[model samples]
Target: MAKRENIGLSRELRQTENRAEEEAWQTLRLLRKEGWPVRRQHQIGPYIVDFAITKARLVIEVDGGIHREQEVAARDVEREGVLRADGWNVLRVSAQFARHGDHLIEMVRAEIKRCCPLTLHPSPQGERGT
Candidate 1:
């Protein structure tokens, strides 16, 4: 019961986060064609990720200006600590994915290839495997 409530509250917070991270992920999603699985506003237990590829050990965090503030920064650092302990490497990007488009996709692809090359597959004939 308590866990369900926690999950509900966490989802609500994630909804808020989605509005904040909108721009960053639209650009980032292109990496999916490149073979990295991208999940938008994904939840892990109580924490919600802005973008994550679990098997790749990569997490893309889109930081709005609000995250730069001292209090929020501290919390984010703590959040990173917890995530790191769980074996996910974090990458922070700006809010441009939604604004500009597809820029972060290549960046995230490079990071995943660098961090977890074993999971990458070569795309053929300009199509990603379904």
Candidate 2:
């Protein structure tokens, strides 16, 4: 059936993305297992977030600083604009974060603490209330 075929195609597409996502997920999971809740490769408007914590409405990107050249940076800035326009916080982690031990973990932890307060529970003072 056409529906079955479509499902198969969808599965294939997801698999392709999953492989790339896994590399990033492995690093994030290390922090998550320590108590920071994270979602792997979530979808935003016209983009797939490398990691997202919806509870904090934060998007975390594990970039290798591979976006070289002005054009690439411009595109990234534009993408960020789109994301920001939608009321989301963005965090870009570089090779230093995950490649080294403990440092990246701490950074992720701090970000979660910061963003979490903004998401699940908002306070009247324009910050999330505990």
Candidate 3:
């Protein structure tokens, strides 16, 4: 369980998140509604991600205008490398992906399937009828 203080902080962060972050949250919330176990503004190691799929060990980042800066880009690369080394798959999406619409969720679903094939498997009883 999350500490009450941490939970409050998470709520505050969500409330204060930028437009791109809010857009990403909509798509991530859709994933959660679909039972994908997605979380928003989740902390991992020393960093906080825009979204994360806990079971799949996947991190989704929504990059905005600041990411265009050379220093920020370099730091993002390093952050991704560290996450990768720690056995997490990172997906970086542009803010435009969110502003455009549901395409972003589709992309995330595709990445989830690619990274965690077990998510696509049929139940032990066997494949269900079409």
Candidate 4:
């Protein structure tokens, strides 16, 4: 269950999302329609991630110019450490790359495949039940 505070924060964050995040969300929505089960502004632990594939334990962060600041980058590193310790894979994409529709979707798809290849594809008949 999502914490009360995080839920509110997520709501606020969603409302103020940057252009890159908006583009990423559009791609995520398409992936969801294709059965990828993506969620936007999802709460995980004490943080609300930009996008999450819960089953695959993947967190996608669309970083804008602000993320390049030293303080923000440091905080991001700490947050990523915590999430990784909890067994999550974090993928960060720059605002510029994320704003490119095709590139963003392709990158996300590649990450998903890397994280959960077996679940996404069936074993060959000869390899099955081996």
The prediction achieving the highest TM-score against the true structure is 4
Candidate 4 Cα lDDT to native: 0.83
What is the C-alpha lDDT profile of model 4 across 1-130, one tens digit per residue?
Answer: 4599888889999999988889888877777654576778988888899998776788999898899999999999999999999999999988888888888888878888898888764332222121
Assess candidate 1 and give its lDDT. Answer: 0.69
Q: How far is 71's C-alpha from truth in model 3 (Å)?
A: 0.9
Give lDDT: candidate 4, residue 77.
100
Give Cα-based local distance difference scores for all models: 0.69, 0.63, 0.78, 0.83
- Worst 10-residue lDDT window for candidate 1 reads 121-130
- For 101-124, candidate 3 gives per-residue lDDT tens digits of 478888888888899887764234
lDDT of 3 at 67: 96
State residue 43's C-alpha deviation in candidate 1, in Å: 1.6
Error of 2 at 56 (Å): 1.1
Model 2, span 1-130: residue lDDT tens: 3555555554554466533345556666665444445666556666766677665677877665565568877887898889988988888766455455456556766776776654443332322331
Pairs that collide in candidate 2 are none
Best by the lDDT measure: 4
| Pairs that clash in candidate 1 | 23-98, 27-102
Q: Model 2, residue 3: what's the lDDT?
A: 55
C-alpha positional error of residue 60 in candidate 1 after TM-score superposition, expressed in Å: 0.8
